[model samples]
Target chain A: MHTRAKLALSLTAVSTVLGLMIGVQYRQTSATAALGLGYLRGTVDTHTLTELKNLKASNQAAEQELTQLNDELNQFERVSSGSDKAMTAFQQRLTDERILAGITAVEGPGISVTLSDGASNGSDVEQILTHDWNVRSVINELFTAGAEAVSINGYRVVATSGVFCSGPVVRVNNHRLGAPFTIEAIGDPETLKSALDIQGGILDVLRMQGLNVTVPQIKQKIVMSAYTGSLPGSPTYSLNEAIPSLSNNGT
Target chain B: MIWLPILGLLIGAAVGLVSNWTIPVEYSSYLSIAILAALDTVFGGIRANLEKTFDDVVFLTGFFTNIFVAALLAFIGVQLGVDLYLAAVVAFGVRLFQNIAVIRRLVVTQIRAKRRRRFNTTS
Candidate 1:
């Protein structure tokens, strides 16, 4: 009887500790859930998580440096071009070129298209998941329909931007992106929507392939952020050299 | 009398919930493995008591040692780029099931013996 009492007492002690830890673990998981990172629970590779944090920090630093350099350049240009008609005209042309180069944030009427993976119910897994080609084709159709500016997952689509598959994720402007892909295009909303919505078009093809493709959502005003990635530092072809040959042709 | 241990478990859980204390996310795996080890030890203790083999020193020491050794193995596994924690998980999981099975059979036999005693006296 004494031994029985002792056994019960010891078991109770051990159980208490177990219950406490289980409670703590439950609370910790829910805390992560509150941060929207609950899905990462056991699936998150700590190595990659740390790497992502470091990369984000460096990217932020680079953006700040770029902004500072741009401000200095703009101040110099404003001071030098003051009270000079030719210089002001040149400045205006430079601004227009910057807009076209996608280095400047643009805002106008356009459409936003969202594409996501379909249900993976005992079918071709490849057909259900969104791929790089799907994103590229959508952007191409939008541009052909008069989209002046386009962006995928907030990464501005510049002339040199490459879209390709990177394992399970899609790489846009060398940044890995996952679904749902939000492609924002600044253009005539009605025209862009109609172009993508045409019968047997790219959107229809994707829908047929068991992908979730949103009919282009027309917005009265949508803002596309500037491309922050590095660009070519030096140009091999100079516009100054081409001007001389143009003048000769005119003569 | 059996409810005593269960009440203690509820009290501990309540204290943990109210405290709002938690370890870092990275250490959660280690903690979970440790919890599994503790549970295995607790069930093993119950089975030992039912079988007349319960030892206070062994039960208490086993509870702490199991938790510590399991967590240590997991930490080392992380450093060695191995899943050694899985070994702990499998070992403890199997033992936990065995202990529970023994405890269930012992309880059922005890209940049967009591019923038989009552029938014999009434007859």
Candidate 2:
């Protein structure tokens, strides 16, 4: 072949190789970009899946802890309810005191008061909702009417239990409770019902504030759960033993 | 010679489009560097041909060597925890641009000379 033809053939071969490489490189780069995007999405999915797994593990651990605690309580109850007469008497008195102190769950014929937010028709929003004081007044009235035990929304009302408003919700024993508050009191059903429904009383006051109050005549079974919160420390006071002289009392 | 090269380019492109070949992601960086180096050589060949200093042996040798050296540099950079492929890209990119600029100027000057000759003949 002539030198010109040889050169032409060689140039053609080189251009062919160049073009092939460029095409392949273009396809490869695009594929790499796509692969990189998929990898990023996979990383996010992996992280979310790992977080969900961790939450499930923690929930399982908490359930196990609750079961262990329940087993311990059952064992204590079994031992306390043994066959010795004197032990039985002591156990009875202990249970009675626990019920009176709101430390034990009690169930009997009593009153169930359901308080709910009223309709807001151009009325103040606060007036429509039951507040902390409303719950406290109802509880006080029930106790004065010889209530044996009381609970608001399953939270047993004890001596140290506090009822206060935290934003739109009422907190009993530091647990947040929302309206349709079911206040259950174990007592003489007729007496408790009459005490709450008396003219110009707690029920009337609640009604005046535009709250929806429902007092069923007498629930056959009203259950009040034991208080689950720790009691606050009592206030310490120094003793004043000195007696006053009668001479100062004349003035 | 030019027509042969163009024909070869079309054939290569057709082959590339029809084939289902793929390179792995890990080697794509090296391939990209090699492509850049090859591009620089191809443009350099075109410039050499225009300047009447074109040599087939030199063009072929430079094409293979540039791709090899660029790919090797990228591999070494990966092992050394450095992005040495970026250096190859910059070098090849600058050379490619310079060659393109020279080619454009040459083509433009040739067109203007041809136009001037036509005008002289018409007048």
Candidate 3:
């Protein structure tokens, strides 16, 4: 009888353990199964689905409109190119001027300067990052060194282009750019290198400020994209006429 | 003897219900196979008790060995990239059904015999 009681007790203990394991397994499996089912069914409603479809359709329409505009531009170019000899010559000069003004994409042998943030090493964060002034200074040096055309972070440095610090980032031509900034300039490689590397130049100034500046490396061919922002319309009046000098008028 | 298994089952369920601890998903498959093996042993134990041949040592050892061997098989099956746990499931399932069938027969016979004795006494 005692042995029989012992047997019952042991069986009870084992069964309890078995029950616990079974309960836990059942709960986990069901939980995972429900999650899997939820994912399979998804949570998107008809409204969201319709919105997505409409967005895709509008994107396709916009793309078609762009293609149509490009075609019209090409046709105008072709007609202008085949007109009178004098007109053709004027068009050629206009194209050359456009290239010089960075209104058109230019490709030629040039040098690229890459500037990245320097290691902080527990120092001031501001000193370790490339600032707007650093980018502007680099562009100034490149132009002074006879760089035919220059672009900073893919934004062409045209007459009206502005680079300024906005909070933690640098804004160029109204577009925000972060490190590392790749400055590509099309010019005589040797002249650009010598001008940038002159003793106590912009590079040394940037390096002293704890910014990681790469020495300009000459590339066999560099392609720069044209400025995409709208340019100011031609002035209506001649600048040769002197404006009436403004005097302090009593309010 | 009859109430012992029921008490064991109730205790086991209580312990399982009260504990919030859980095994990871990766080991759930092994746990499932162990559960199936254990259920088989429980049914086998009940059937043995009904037949007056139940042994405490055999029941206890069977419970542990069944879970260990089933888990090990599942682990090895995973290592070999094979569904070996299915085999354990099928085997345990077949035996479980067989044990339940016998238990059912034993219960029905015992009921019929009691009814016969009562009928004879009343007549």
Best by DockQ: 1
Those runs of model 2 whose alpha carbons end farther than 4 Å from true positions after fitting are: A1-7, A36-251, B1-3, B120-123
TM-score of 1: 0.44
* Local accuracy of candidate 1 as per-residue lDDT tens digits, B7-115: 9899888887779697999999998999999999988898888898999999999999999999999999999999999999999999999999999999999999999
Q: Where does model 3 exceed 4 Å of error?
A: A1-4, A30-251, B1-4
Model 3, range A192-225, lDDT digits (tens) per residue?
9888888899898899889998988999898899
Model 1 over residues A89-174: C-alpha lDDT tens digits?
65577656766678778899999999999998799999999999999999999889988899998899988889999999999988
Question: For candidate 1, what is the lDDT?
Answer: 0.85
Displacement of residue B40 (Cα, Å) in model 1 is 0.6
Query: Which TM-score value belongs to model 3?
Result: 0.44
Q: In candidate 2, what are the lDDT values of residues A1-251, reduced to their tens digit?
A: 36467567767887898788777877766665566654778667878999999999987886686567556644654565564564456557756876887755788999898999899999798778888898899999999999989888888998888899999899998899998888888989999999999999999999999999996568898766777776543111100111021112211
Q: Estimate each model's TM-score.
A: 0.44, 0.42, 0.44
**Considering only N, C-alpha and C atoms within 3 Å, which residue pairs clash in candidate 2?**
none
How far does residue B104 in candidate 3 sit from its true spot (Å)? 0.4
lDDT (Cα, 0-100) at B118 in candidate 3: 100
Best prediction by lDDT: 1
* Native contact share for candidate 3: 0.63
